[model samples]
Target: MNSLKTVWAIAWRRFSENSAIAAEMNGRFIATVFYCTVLVPFGILSALFMDPLRIKGKPPRWLQREPVPTDMDSARRQG
Candidate 1:
């Protein structure tokens, strides 16, 4: 579309005007693309396969944490 092209052209002009900032922005854009295309899908597949609720293996230590007391009395006692 013409609007899209115009937007891209403006962006390119700005990018060309600031080489150092453009390089940093380009790195961030690549990182975002990589995360969206690769890391996020991989994480989803890992979570699906390693269903935390199913517990096929020894669960992580964090999951075994004892509940902390939340009442005011318990907090006062601790303090």
Candidate 2:
């Protein structure tokens, strides 16, 4: 009875260890596949079509400065 219990305990330990390692490996593989297939392609398509950065032709809005108000413009505004 004691020997049987020992064997069962060892088997349970081995199974738990193997399951933990397998779960880690499968999780990593699934994440990589999702990133490559879904996230990466969506990012590429959005960059190409949506122009989020305004990189196609027009400069980004932050890079453009509003035209400085000239003295004439100030005078006109005052008038």
Candidate 3:
């Protein structure tokens, strides 16, 4: 039918436009796939082998919290 031909023409036009953009970024697309497929696993394996808890240094300051004061006065006030 004529309607089917019109639908195919529109679909092909959109596909061609999208393919042009994809071709322009082909290198970046490959790099992203490579990083996810390779570097991400390697990094995860390295972390597992390194014993993350055994790192010999002070933890980042943001992770350190001020000790909660356990004074009897504060506890009685809340209760």
Candidate 4:
């Protein structure tokens, strides 16, 4: 059908004209982006949620919320 040819042409154009597509057609960039977005976060969250059962060493400290030192006037007030 004529529609098939037109669709193929559009697909070819998409493949050719896009600079990103021109870089890597073997899908490495896409896989890298997907791994960065999905697997890295998943790994981080998994490690955070799971307890270290003393199979190796002490568990690392979790991040704690702390107040910033906004009292810079302490030195001036003292002097």
Which digits, one per residue and each the tens of the lDDT, describe model 4 over residues 1-79? Answer: 9999999999988877796665666488788999999999999998988766755466778898885556878656765
Per-residue lDDT tens digits of candidate 1, residues 1-79?
A: 9999999999999888898788899999999999999999999999778776776676566655689989999999996
Best by the TM-score measure: 2
C-alpha lDDT of candidate 2 relative to the true structure: 0.89
lDDT of 3 by residue, 6-30 (tens): 9999999999999999887997889
User: How far out, in Å, is residue 2 in model 1?
Assistant: 45
* RMSD (Cα, Å) of model 3: 10.7
Clashes of each: 0, 0, 0, 0
Deviation of model 4 at 56, angstroms: 14
lDDT of each: 0.89, 0.89, 0.88, 0.80
Which residue ranges in model 4 land beyond 4 Å of their true spot? 1-26, 52-79
**Per-candidate RMSD, Å:** 15.0, 6.6, 10.7, 13.5
lDDT of 2 by residue, 1-79 (tens): 9999999999999999999999999999999999999999999898768965556886557776688677887878876
Ten contiguous residues minimizing lDDT sum, candidate 4: 50-59
* Clash pairs for candidate 4: none
Model 1: pairs clashing at backbone N, Cα or C within 3 Å: none
TM-score of each: 0.43, 0.64, 0.35, 0.34
